[model samples]
Target: MQYWRKPLDADKIQVPHGEIHIVRDRCKGCGFCVEYCPRDVLELSKQFNIKGYHPPEAVLPEACVHCQLCEMLCPEFAIFVTLREEVETIES
Candidate 1:
């Protein structure tokens, strides 16, 4: 299961960036997302959600490769990642 795949044309990708959304109420505090994150982007937050469970926090948003490993591993389907717009540099 490859989440992030680099294109053959390296120049197409400008910079790595993405956003993670965690549905707090749906989280069971299983720590799956935090543990499976390849980049250690997520952490179990100190704050508890409505269900009285700790949800995942994007501690390292910039480090996230948007792999979606967290989403796949989460049994509760509490988290997902969305890729940010690429800031492509026009080659002069």
Candidate 2:
């Protein structure tokens, strides 16, 4: 949750903007992200996968707080969160 508010240096990290990759086959739909994420970006899908379990879906990209808890907690390692600078506005 706190990481979302922190700014990352471009030289340190280079990743895509607001991109969260979720693999359906790998997801177990445990809803751990749903429980851990403060921003509530992930949600349980109604449809079931081949494994007979509902996978987690990124319903809102903007709502992601970039906490990385989803990535850490995922037992199947199905989620990826990449951070990138969307703008170059100087804050005073």
Candidate 3:
């Protein structure tokens, strides 16, 4: 089985279609989520979690493209992403 794959182009991915959820307590301040986020959506928060580690925050909420890099790369299972359904447009 192929275990490695090329990273997607963030510019080609649609934006404003998703959101990320942070499991603060589960995070260990590993920074993988922030580092691998394709759209630079996440950042380390100044505030600490109950574990006394700085969890990542969705700093650029509008830029998120539901690429799931943050969710996949996080060893601590701290963050996850959800994609919004596309709104259909009706032609007049």
Candidate 4:
């Protein structure tokens, strides 16, 4: 089965800078998000969250491409990706 490769227009396929979010309380520490993120943006840590499990961390925020695949694959739905506002450049 063929799949969408993300639209190409700058408006629809914008490569916006983005960030990752981890819901500390809801994470189950199953490592599902850590393993599935294509960009390898997440990592398992020795530190634990309020729920007592070692929640996933955004170890490499710069590596994220805002694909949202990890967020969709997470069983607990505790992960989210937020796009940062583009910094408009001024040309002299």
Which one is best on lDDT?
1
Q: Give per-residue lDDT, candidate 3, residue 82.
A: 88
Superposed by TM-score, candidate 3 places the C-alpha of residue 31 at a distance from the truth, in angstroms, of: 0.5
Provide TM-scores for the models: 0.75, 0.70, 0.74, 0.71
TM-score, candidate 4, is 0.71
Q: Residue 32 error for model 2, in Å?
A: 0.5
Report the error of model 4 at residue 20, Å.
0.6
Alpha carbon lDDT of each predicted model:
0.79, 0.73, 0.76, 0.75
lDDT of 4 by residue, 1-92 (tens): 12255334434433445588888788889998888887777899888888899888888886677788878888888888888776322220
Among all windows of ten consecutive residues in candidate 1, which has the lowest summed lDDT? 83-92
Q: Write the per-residue lDDT of candidate 3 for residues 1-92, one digit (tens) a residue.
A: 11155335533543345778999989999998888777778899999899899999988986676778888888887788888775222220
lDDT of 2 by residue, 10-83 (tens): 34553334568888888888888877876778889899988999998888886564568888898889887877
Clashing residue pairs in candidate 1, if any? none
Ranking by lDDT: 1, 3, 4, 2
Better of 2 and 4 by TM-score: 4
